[model samples]
Target: MAEAAALSRPAGVVGRRTWANGLFVLPFFLTFLALMVLPLGVGMWLSFQDYDMLGGYGGSVGFENFTRLWEDKIFLRSVLNTVYFVCLSTPAFVALGLFLAISLNDTYRRSAVLRSIFFGSSVLSVTIVTLIWRLVYMPERGLLAVSAGAVGLSSPSFMTTESLAMPGIAIVTVWWIIGLPMMLFLAALQQIPREVYEAAALDNASRWTTLTRITLPSIRRTIVLVAVIEVILQFQIFGQVHLITNGGPNNATRPIVMFIYEAGFRDWSLGYAAAASQVLFVLMLAASFFQIWIGRSKQED
Candidate 1:
């Protein structure tokens, strides 16, 4: 009877511990369900139905909204513009970030100050960044214009020209987002074993060879991560264009997210907007998978 009671006591303690662990994790699970899962499920449902704020939910239209999107010239244009922005901005962000990270890693004096200066812009709110750039890009009265005028040249309107609008936004995005990848690369660089570099030095390996073989391979994973993250972030770009250009210059700068926002709220086409969002989501997911596959293939090679 005494041995049986002792065994039962252990079981009770185990049960209590299991309960305590569940209790500790319960809030996070509940929050995730309420905030992420629930909204995503509802959004999926709304994409299939004819949902309008004023008209209320109507009969299911199946893929009618999606079909219309394919034929929508404006929507298609926005999609193309978004792709263009992602392509133009992502490479610049990743390359510049890696370059800066490598340079800073080699620097021994005031490295922290330089890192902070580069990363300080990223910590600012999106609204603040947009407003600050708005002033910087404003023609005649803006800093760029003022500097150009002092040199006996006029500054072209950065936000208004069709050719320059998207690139202008891309530049701002790169400046704003470069710090994250830089810091990520810096961390990855620090993790690399110094003995490998010492051996390379003993072998008299050229700088280019060392970079291509040693440094890059060591930080390949971090490079993939930064590239994937940049692609995802740039693909969904809207805030800067919305606040700065308002997708002007004949919608040349408009992106998919901005179009979806306009459709859902401004035009009151919730179902159509939801369909567009789902399409964007799918594109981003595909891009991410493709990048991961490419990275894995390179690693294997």
Candidate 2:
């Protein structure tokens, strides 16, 4: 009777454990299906059909939207503009973040304050950020113009100028995002053991040599991670350009996301918009893979 009781207890415990694990995982699986899988599947299906809200779904056109996208000049321009923004902003984000992290890694009282100041901007919503910068870039009356006037110089119209508009937006993006990478780098820096630095000091290593040999090599993985993340995020840039420029000054700052919005909601071309979104998704996936390949190669070397 005692042996039978012990066997029965084990079966009951296993049944309870299974149910507990399933309960914990069920919410995540449901959320993922609702949010990600369902939307993606719907979008892909819509892309092949002539989907119009007023007229309802037309018969499948078989890549007609994609072909049209190839010939659409404005859409092509938006893609180029997105690439340009990514190119302009990514390096600045990575370099400045790394610089700040290295400079502020000390335990000094002022370092903590400085770190907070740099990172505080990131916590603000994109709407708040754009509004603040809008006032800063306002012509003649904005803070930037007023400051320039005080110094006997004229302020450039940031949003109105075609040549400077995208780059100007890039600057704002870099400022907003630099904090994330900076904190990541700081964490990576802290993970480096103190004994390694002590050994370098004992060997009479110069500051530059120590940095080049010890510090950088130790954080190589973090650098690659930051670079890839920055690239992916910058490629989707829309909020700043949307709020500040509205793709103005002759659509000079229009990125792919804005184009997608225009096609879908404004123009009522859901099929075409879906196609454009797929293109952007493919581009991002390719870029991510390329970065991962480079990271793996470096690690192997």
Candidate 3:
């Protein structure tokens, strides 16, 4: 009886621990289901329905909404513009973040003040960021204009120029988001064993070799993570453009998210907006998987 009690005690403890773990996770699971899963499911359903602001669900439209997207010149342009922004912004996000992380990861340079300065902008609201940058981009009187005047150059209105508008927004976004990747890389850099660098130094490994071989390889997964996150984020860019250019100067700066917002709220075409949203979801999903595959392939190589 004593042996049986001892055996049963372990099983009872395991059961209680399992229940405790489930209880701990229950809140997050419920929140996710309520917030993420339900919205996504509803969006998918709405994509198939002929929904609107006034009439609500006006019955199913089948694939007409999705199929019509191909014929949408504005939608196609928005998609292209979004891709352009992603291409413009992602490299800077990854490279600049890595550069800043590597530069500041050292013992002597790991200054809290400096990190905070770089990271400070990211915590600001998008509206604030746009407002601040609006002053910087304001023609003939703003910081850039003043500086350009000082240099005997003219600073044209960036927000009005089709060629420069998206780039201007991209620059602002980079300033806002670069800090996160830097922090992520910094954390990953710290995780690398000190002994590895010490051995590299002892073996007469040059700085370039140390970075290319040891530093990057050690943080490859973090690199992929930062890249993927930036790609997904930049692809969905809307707030900056909405506040800055309002997708003006020939729709050169409009993005897919902005299109969805306008289509749903502005035009009251909720079904069409939901279809566009799903397309975006699929694009983001595909891009993430492709990046993960590429990262894994390189890691394997």
Which candidate do you rate higher for TM-score, 2 or 3?
Answer: 3
Q: Among all windows of ten consecutive residues in candidate 2, which has the lowest summed lDDT?
A: 3-12
Residue-level lDDT tens digits of model 2 in 210-295: 99999988999998899899888988988999999999889899999999998898989898899999999899888888888888
Candidate 3 on 26-125: residue-level lDDT in tens?
9999999999999999999999989889877689999999999989999999998988998899989999999999888876645767788899988999
Could you list the CA RMSD of all candidates, in the order they appear? Answer: 3.2, 3.4, 2.6
Ranking by lDDT: 3, 1, 2
| TM-score sort, best first | 3, 1, 2
Off by over 4 Å in 2: 1-23
| lDDT (10s digit) by residue, model 1, range 1-301 | 9878767787779799889989989999999999999988888888888888888888899999999999999999999999999999888977998999988996666888899999999998889989999999998899899999999998988888999999999988988878999999999999999999999999999999999999999999998999899889989998989989999889999999999999999989899999999999998999889888988999999
Would you give me the overall lDDT of model 3? 0.92
Judging by lDDT, tell me the better candidate of 1 and 3. Answer: 3
TM-score, candidate 1, is 0.91
